[model samples]
Target: MSEQRTHSPQEPQRRPRITHNRKKTRRSKAAAALLYVLFVVGLSAVLATVGWIWANDLLALNKDYTSVIVKVENDESFGEVVNDLKKNGLIEYKFLFHLYGWFSNADDKIAPGTYELNTDMDYRALVTNMSASSSTRQTIDITIPEGYTIDQTFALLEEQGVTTVEKLQDMSANWNYKFTWLKDLPLGDYHRLEGYLFPDTYTFYLGEDAKYVINKMLVNFESKMGDYMDQFTEESQYSLHDIITIASLIEKETDGEDYGTIASVIYNRLENTGAETQGYLQIDATLVYLNGGKVPTEEDKAIDSPYNTYLYKGLPAGPISNPGMKAITAALKPENTNYYYYVLNPETNKHEFTRTYAQHQALVEKYGTANEEG
Candidate 1:
């Protein structure tokens, strides 16, 4: 009864004091978890930054290395190209390129075209260039002569310090290149370097292989011919190889643009009355070709070879030389005029066109004699 009479209000008890050791432990655990998360995040960031730099720092420092990328448009695979790049010293990191391509989902979508890539290209620019549909490759201004034979072309290459004739011959021997027009050739041998070595100012590089040169010439030939091959075959009742054969004849006839009328004259001769077994194309150039590209003397005409037009009566065995687009076009559309004989004015290196054989004979007399004594 006495205790109940006091009836004092109860006070809330204070929480128990936290131990110093416990506080330390809790802080240490939280700090360790935060540190682990930070370490993981840092590791992830570092992995993301892989392939951000090229090993060749000087290369990266010198050029913009952006926008321009060598895009390979062939059916070649990425791994093959990567290996090529490594060999070419164009790529410093193979795995990184693969990673970049995979991350960008462009691994299988690489476009088939040659592209020029500048150095210092980032991951984005790399993929962009590789994914483009087409790209222009670096080119060298290679000039093939009007009547340059395959061997002559190789010789020119050797002279330019590009490659040797032996290497080219080895490549040709190693692989047989058969074209559509090859089957139409007499001996099934039209494709080698017969009509495709287009005479033009092409662009090439220092490390360009023979295949690259051949492809460029082929592309140029295709561009020039277009639909003319089929049309010429239909109109002249000759095969595409035949058209090129005539074009090659025209190329050997003259060095430059003057061959247009000469090309027409050849057709005219074929259609004329003095035709000798498919019109004995008594081309002096053929004799010159047969005489190891030397000016043939009267005695050399007796030599027998399929390439000698003076002896054999039809197109030569193969293209005597690489002809330019002008020569090709002239072959496609020969002139309507009919002038059988032509003599190059020695002073001008141009031919005087004459329709009648008497006029030709008179000019020959005026020039000197029938043998071209010069």
Candidate 2:
């Protein structure tokens, strides 16, 4: 300003204007850069928030442990399964679960059954639990006692909700079980598998197919009798069916205390068919079986039935009851003795073996009781 000596007016005004324009340009550029940074930061925060929510759902993070029972139909679609999960409060995001299922190919791996799922399970675990061999599938522990008849067993199965008795009966009669011993026994009779179903505690799936349930018992029976199968088939004069029949008789006769002695008496009676015993067996349990689980009266022995060992000679048509391993073994290997008669002693609650009719009559008179079984 002090040096304003003869300067041109157009030149001074041009310099000031150029400086002002440069300052304005620098301020505008700084503001633009700040606005761009704020925009980038805001977009990044929004994207991060969305990513966190998605990852949390996919991973099942921060979820309370809650159990839910899910039943998947055989023909249920993946969409239906996702809907069930949502309805059961197992999943938060149905679409996200569908996306995960699509990526993991879970549609092809799901199986038809009832499953027990929890909320803490991740997407991968959920898919795995829906598989055929899932451990989380619902199951029932059924203990079929020894001596359960086919009807009784089926009733128990139905009672436990494992299957219907009608279905079990139908399958038992029609299913052609692949086993050598089963060949001689024809179909069309549900009692064909009466003595073969093993009696043990079994874990069955809820609403299990009747065929599968029957197969499990049959397979268990085969495995349990595997060691004795060869012996019963080859060396023994009796067929495998015959052994089971005799064992069933023994099982129904006594309370497992006199199994071996009863077996000896039975063998003796069979051997001396022409002797005083006349091979009648005279087992009261047989009459009881034919009399509809009633205590056999004196007239009940005269009933005409193949299962009536008192009337029919030799073994019955089939097993009278499902015998345990002890009774079965006793039948396979009977004790060698000359006993042809036996009577239950009321005082001792055990059968007294006799070689002659006179001794048996004496015990019967002394005990003042008819025979329990022999």
**What are the Cα lDDT values of the candidates?**
0.65, 0.83
Which residue runs does candidate 1 get wrong by more than 4 Å? 1-140, 173-179, 183-191, 232-236, 255-257, 273-278, 370-374
Worst 10 residues of 2 by lDDT: 8-17
lDDT for each residue of candidate 2 in 1-374, tens digit (9 for 90 to 100)? 57766955675444345878889999999999999999999989988988888777778887888999997765579999999998988888999998888888999988766799998888898889988799987889999987777778899988987777888888889999888889989999888998888888999876677888899998998888878887755666898998888888888775558788778888888778897889878888778778778888989978988988878898888987778887888888888888888877776777778888888888878877654346
Write down the RMSD of all candidates, one decimal each: 9.8, 9.6
TM-score of each: 0.58, 0.69
Q: What's the CA error at residue 307 for candidate 1, in Å?
A: 1.4
Q: Model 2, which residues run further than 4 Å from truth?
A: 1-66, 70-114, 118-130, 232-236
The clash count of every prediction, one per candidate, is: 18, 0
